[model samples]
Target: MAARVGLNGQAPRCDHIDLLPAVEPGLPECKECLALGQAWTLLLVCLTCGWVACSDDSPGGHAREHYRETDHPVVAALAPETAWRWCYVHGRIV
Candidate 1:
């Protein structure tokens, strides 16, 4: 599958992306959703503060929530397709 491109047809530099911590291979769960007894289809970890949240496809959309709350722009997929990273601020994949 193709990684998502920005609507503007430009991919931002990965170096510009804010990464607080490398993805955790050990913990594959979304902490926030688990606390409420919810399951997640996908997991995204905030690249700024290493916060874990469920993807929009999942029930809570906590990944976007983390972005809204902290403006932490980049998030790496916590599990599947680990090569891709998303920028919530510019709305692109890097």
Candidate 2:
């Protein structure tokens, strides 16, 4: 969903970009527990449950791991000011 600034307030619009659906949604927390350690390079936002995970190429691959444990469906790049998300199934930006 795109963040919109309305006259009176802000609104969130679901752009609905085609992307690969996550294989799983209810994945266990990061096994390596890197989540508790250092900062991450990239953040993947789970469209299914809004769980944020680190990119697969990172130390833990928490993002892809989230997909393996839970079929949440959608994920977005969680970078600052970058609201673009990706769908794994469709391989498109959502």
Candidate 3:
């Protein structure tokens, strides 16, 4: 997969693209949300370690929290229809 490239055919503007896993893992639900007994609207997978967490719009906001704690940087939407990645450091879709 083209880990460094975005849908627009531009390389992501952050250094964390190099940290993506060879294969982004699939997960059924946001583990953090489940643990917190909260509901989530979107799921995101950490590109660095394949961590699954809820989007910022969710009550848990675990995906953004994970980045704040780990500095892992990149996360991709886990929904099959959303083929986009987000860079936490840059605060934009990569």
Give the clashing pairs for model 1: 20-47
Report lDDT (CA) for all predictions.
0.76, 0.60, 0.82
Model 1 TM-score is 0.71
Ranking by lDDT: 3, 1, 2
Q: List ranges where model 3 is wrong by over 4 Å.
A: 1-12
Worst lDDT run of 10 residues, candidate 1, spans 17-26
The candidate that achieves the highest lDDT relative to the unseen native structure = 3
Task: Tell me the spans in candidate 1 whose CA falls farther than 4 Å from its real position.
Answer: 1-15, 18-26
TM-score of each model, in listed order: 0.71, 0.54, 0.77
Evaluate model 2: give its lDDT.
0.60
Tens digits of per-residue lDDT for model 3 on 34-89? Answer: 87788999888888888888999998899899899998889998877888998888
Candidate closer to the true structure by lDDT (higher is better), 2 or 3: 3
Look at candidate 1 and tell me the lDDT of residue 31: 82
Provide the global lDDT of candidate 3 against the true structure.
0.82
